[model samples]
Target: MELKSFKFDLDERQVKWIFSPLRDKIQVIELLMKIIKIILVDDKLDSERIKGKVVLRVSKMSRLFFFSEDKFFSINFPFLVFHANKDLSFQSKNGNKVDNKVTSDVLGLLASEVLLSSDHVLEFADPVADIEDYNSGFWSLLKELLLFEDGYIRYDYDDKHVNGQRHPLNHLDIFYCSGSTFKIGLRQRITDNHLMDLLDLETDSHFLERL
Candidate 1:
């Protein structure tokens, strides 16, 4: 007796809906890039250029790390995987080529969770300063900041695990708190537009007048 084999291919529409998480992730990446660009261009921020060609990187588990060159600051996507059934096509894949289209999601959801953490201090390096001195004052401030004794914005998202009045799915953990109980819950998940708006707000407090 001979056995028959078959392979099924997904159409464009199916590919999109099925892998929407990945698509969302790609969009998130794009949004992050835009924010970074805005920061770099703003003369007030005086953002320091990443020392190497790589400003962002993905680990084997799909978590993303940005501004790796700087020890005190970074943006992390610790849980952006969306796996389902038995699909492991993108398993352990660590590259920036997840999609080719401007907003592509060719790779369907490849994990079971999605989270984002935007961690950074208000201070940036002096653009004209030598590379070696990039972390000068910022590092010292970061040390104190690490103890939750300073002010900073840390946007975090988590939908994987939720409990009543505890770990809200969407919340902003402003300033570093020693305990995780301090959280400001939001009614909806944060979007690229929200982040963009935040960037504008941070850049120019006057922007609020326009809104």
Candidate 2:
């Protein structure tokens, strides 16, 4: 589903505040749209699971807002992919023993490229790893787009910390919303730390477009 298809509710007061001093809001949305485009064109999902999907667009412009009754269920996205980069090594959530024979994992592939039709595709588990500063993997680029301060990526997990468990630091923080089907743009409120952090970085590097 496109941005215009969803029914959106706006807070005029918040809308004005969000649009005034903030910049890069469009850049953030554009990045999200790129991710969504990959998802829409990718043929890695099961057909039965991809049906009955809806896209909800919020009217706010702080950080990109993505939510769904089911994880990645909106816009007919297939199962969500959970990944972790630990000890500078790449692996899936299940702690699949990464042998030199296996090079690319789900998270790495999704972040790097999107395949419309291929031999293998990324699959999603359930729940996800705990929230941690995930600034070490492909998710780091995405996390930077989501929050100005710092955050971790989270997708799916079983939470059965038994033997042979894989814990990834970088993950996406998208989850399920079991509630009424309504549209609400969601973005984190900017903070002094966020502004100062960006200012400090501005003196050295231009990670994003000037707003």
Candidate 3:
């Protein structure tokens, strides 16, 4: 997907707002599910369980949303990834986990390998891990959205570790190359509306058209 195909033009300020974390865990989860439903419905994809296939599942034990089985999405995006720095113990419906020292697991959306031909490609398994925890043992199949120059999109909520001016509490990174980074500092927290708008921009204003 090329950036030219996008319907909305994103300014610097808007980008910052869209990527920051403005809501609590429950609110974030609600927003994510809402967007996922929109995407699946818009593409006419099936999320229902069929032949023992599970598309979406919410784990109360871990306080996370994920899919237990593969082939969930019609597209190559097999997993959805979202992460928060809040502690699992403190996370609840009433209030958010606001402590910066607490380490929490990532709620993620991951990508699968899209084979271009009949050739066999390496297979990868999805696992729940912390941020920056990549295993070098297996080749990663986690490539999420937009084939724009072989680039994928990622959102981060980093309030746990803020070292002076080095790391911003909330920021967005849009990059296509390893060892290269293009970060945008978010002045305000990101809301569900911003996320939906972001998707609309990438999906050629489908959400807006529906409205």
Candidate 4:
């Protein structure tokens, strides 16, 4: 498999949703990268390694109850896996511990699950099918995979030496699959902040009222 790595910065406007309110107020600029490893495996599977700032945005809003007023709560912020060849970026408010390694691991698990449940090829080759169902299905599955565990994943950090110098590293070796299956493996690290922030944001609001 050929893995291509590319890095970029995040846009400043989306930083507020990622960092905690108690965090430092200084400007945090983070560089986000995506390492897409393409392989012609049994079912045309592509493993993606996404590394970047863990800023999340609540793109949609839902009501608390079936007939309740429309509230700004009950939002879903799927992990944004920026394509290595795309022109998207993110900037942080406080640039402390802005390492992509941690975030990459989180995304690796997400990517794995998404690929596992996604349909690689369609039976019909209709152009309209690609536009409507194919694209929507892919994104829907991706979002479910990211928010599968309600962002309850864990990480372990360790110190390593390279060229006689010690460096800090984060590893995401454990995760819950389908909010049921538990799996542990050594893979690239991705931050859990993105998932945690989503949960925090969601739980703060009354979502059932909007549903």
Rank candidates, TM-score, best first: 3, 1, 4, 2
TM-score of each: 0.27, 0.19, 0.27, 0.19
| Per-residue lDDT of candidate 2, residues 75-161 (tens digit) | 221112222331112233333322222222323333433332344534211101111122133343333333443111122221343
Candidate 3 or 2, higher TM-score = 3
lDDT (C-alpha, whole model) for all candidates: 0.31, 0.28, 0.30, 0.27
**Candidate 3, superposed: residue stretches over 4 Å from native:** 1-151, 202-211
Q: Which segments of candidate 1 are over 4 A away from where they belong?
A: 1-151, 179-181, 202-211
lDDT digits (tens) for residues 26-69 of candidate 3: 32433333334332333332334222211222221111111111
Q: State residue 26's C-alpha deviation in candidate 1, in Å.
A: 31
- Which of the two candidates, 1 or 4, achieves a greater TM-score against the reference? 1
Count of steric clashes across candidates, in order: 7, 10, 9, 26
Pairs that clash in candidate 1: 19-108, 19-109, 81-111, 82-110, 82-111, 83-110, 83-111
Highest lDDT, which number?
A: 1
Candidate 4, residue 38: lDDT? 12
Estimate the TM-score for candidate 3: 0.27
Regions of model 4 farther than 4 Å from truth: 18-211
Pick the TM-score winner: 3
TM-score of 4: 0.19
